[model samples]
Target: MTVNIDKLTITTPAATSSTNLVALELSGAQAIERFPQYVTVLSDGSVKLTAPTKGASSKSTHRTRCEWSEPTNWTLASAADHWNRQRMTVTKVNSAQKVVISQIHVRGDDSPPVKVFWNKGNITMGFRTKYNQTTPVNSTVLKGVPLGAEFTVSIHATSKGVVTVEAKCNGVSGSSGALQLDATWGTRLFEFHGGVYNQVDYTNSTPAADGSICVISDLSLSHS
Candidate 1:
């Protein structure tokens, strides 16, 4: 399906902010406020997100991104009654560092309960129900793909709050079985995000001259 650029929103770090924690949304009325620095849309319709080595502050020196979201907000009550799906590929990862490439988040939640990551030389998909849990959903690691390689990842949420995750790379694929959502998430809204979210801090040290660049293509979101 063709994606509607007008309905998509791009978020990145703000240029001038004291807290160094504000994000600039590119699309809404705020689009005119400041031009996006880390996120950009290519002429071919793909999205690219860059994470600088050093950011606004030490607390978090990186940027978070979402490819797109469903127009209508959804909650657990609507579970079993509605569905949300997201798909994207990791076209190019400039570095071998770990990065959050996608997530399924509940509104108001500081962090997404479900996240997909590119770690070292492998792909890891994890999930959590608690805000303070240190461990993620236990699962086997999926082999990594090289540059120009394509990986299709998707998630399907049922009306009963059951979430299913699937991924495909080089003709091999696997599933997360069924992940039961926490009851606490029942009343909260949820959405899908796809793009690079650097997991490292570059403050007071130097790892790579160029932080990292994550390119995602064939991004599409749909719900019913």
Candidate 2:
């Protein structure tokens, strides 16, 4: 069949513009608007995961993974029954130099008087300990501006384990508190230790950057 382009007749309203393109194909369209989805509450008045979309899944899911220069694997193990349980294993790392994981956000307890261990990191600014017993139990407390141009809190833990944090506002004294942090070798501290010591389990400790009154709730040792 021969196609006739000149005989084609289309209906349209008169326009002033000489070049006017009508609606194109359906594929030549873009997203117009987006709206929030409505969710129904359950009988117990609890909102549950009704949809498994990207945003919803993200807000409800927890991620965990490891990263390294070499092959490594991980597995989950019960802390209480460490001796009889299977721990997370780091399997392989062929050529992938790194592994990453977004761990689950743990906010189960917020009460003071909770025990935590120095999972890792330098407890005292300049003081480093080789053994758990050598660690200092912070005692002395103060309130003032840290020694810095911008906002920075100076926490000094002496050999006696005396810990003090001074808040500095514009390089002046602000507020301080006497905090008690316990350094113990527990399951939490296990990973932070045996390496460079850059990890610690800070329980019920409030060290805010916005200059909130930092306080030590229950600073003790965390054990497996």
Best by TM-score: 1
Model 1 spans > 4 angstroms off: 1-5, 16-21, 28-37, 57-72, 79-96, 130-134
- In order, the Cα lDDT scores of the candidates are 0.58, 0.19
Clashes of each: 4, 36
TM-score of 2: 0.19
TM-scores, all models, native as reference: 0.76, 0.19
Q: How many backbone clashes does candidate 2 have?
A: 36
* Candidate 1 lowest-lDDT run of ten: 28-37
Worst 10 residues of 2 by lDDT: 27-36
